[model samples]
Target: MANHRAAWTDERAEQVIGELLRVGVILSVVVILIGAVFYFLHHPAARANYRTFHSEPDDLRSIARIAAGAVKLRPREFIQFGLLLLLFTPVARVAFSVFAFAAERDRTYVIVTLIVLGILISSIVGHI
Candidate 1:
């Protein structure tokens, strides 16, 4: 009876861990897709505009002016850039954790995934 109960508990734990891993994979995919859309929509245009105005900047004065203009970004633009980078960090962490898990098949990855998810969720909720 004791052996049967222990086996059932072990099986249940495995099922729960599997479900968590699936959720982590799905969340990571969604985060990456959203980040890609945002980067294409936002950063590429700004970079193009900056390139158009600055060109090669062959001298010190031109470089100074470009630097000054870059530093003069609007508050909203800064926030958008920060948010884009912030969004990528967790996705990257999850990708690394997945790789770590696949390479070693270690249980430590389950804890790492949970920590990353907790941090991401807290940041999203606290910021809003």
Candidate 2:
């Protein structure tokens, strides 16, 4: 009887692990698709620029020089940068929720994620 119980428990554990793996794969694919859409919509040029900027030490120096040339309008650019940073808050929240749900199957995480997104949207509308 004890042996039979142990075998049943092991089988249940395996089944749970398998289900988690399947969920994880599906969640990963969804996250990737969302990221692709966001990237294409908001900052299609950002990846190319980032690659060039980090390509070498000479590239870094060149980027620095270009930034230095923009010193006169730095204040305006800084404000724009802050707004751009704020725009990412909702995307980050969604990504975090996806991972949390996939790893732990927690419903509270979904609620928290929605709250974060609401706050981000409110802040953006209020501030800008």
User: In lDDT terms, which candidate is top?
Assistant: 1
Which ranges of candidate 1 are over 4 A from the true structure? 1-8, 45-128
lDDT of 2 by residue, 40-69 (tens): 665556544554444433322233432342
Instruction: Please give the distance, in angstroms, between residue 16's alpha carbon in candidate 2 and its true position after superposition.
Output: 0.6
Clashing pairs for model 1 are: none
lDDT of 1 at 93: 53
- Local distance difference test, candidate 1: 0.50
**Candidate 2 positional error at 6, Å:** 7.2
For model 1, how does the per-residue alpha-carbon lDDT over 9-68 read when each residue is reduced to its tens digit?
Answer: 434555655665666566655544654565566555554345356543332223233334
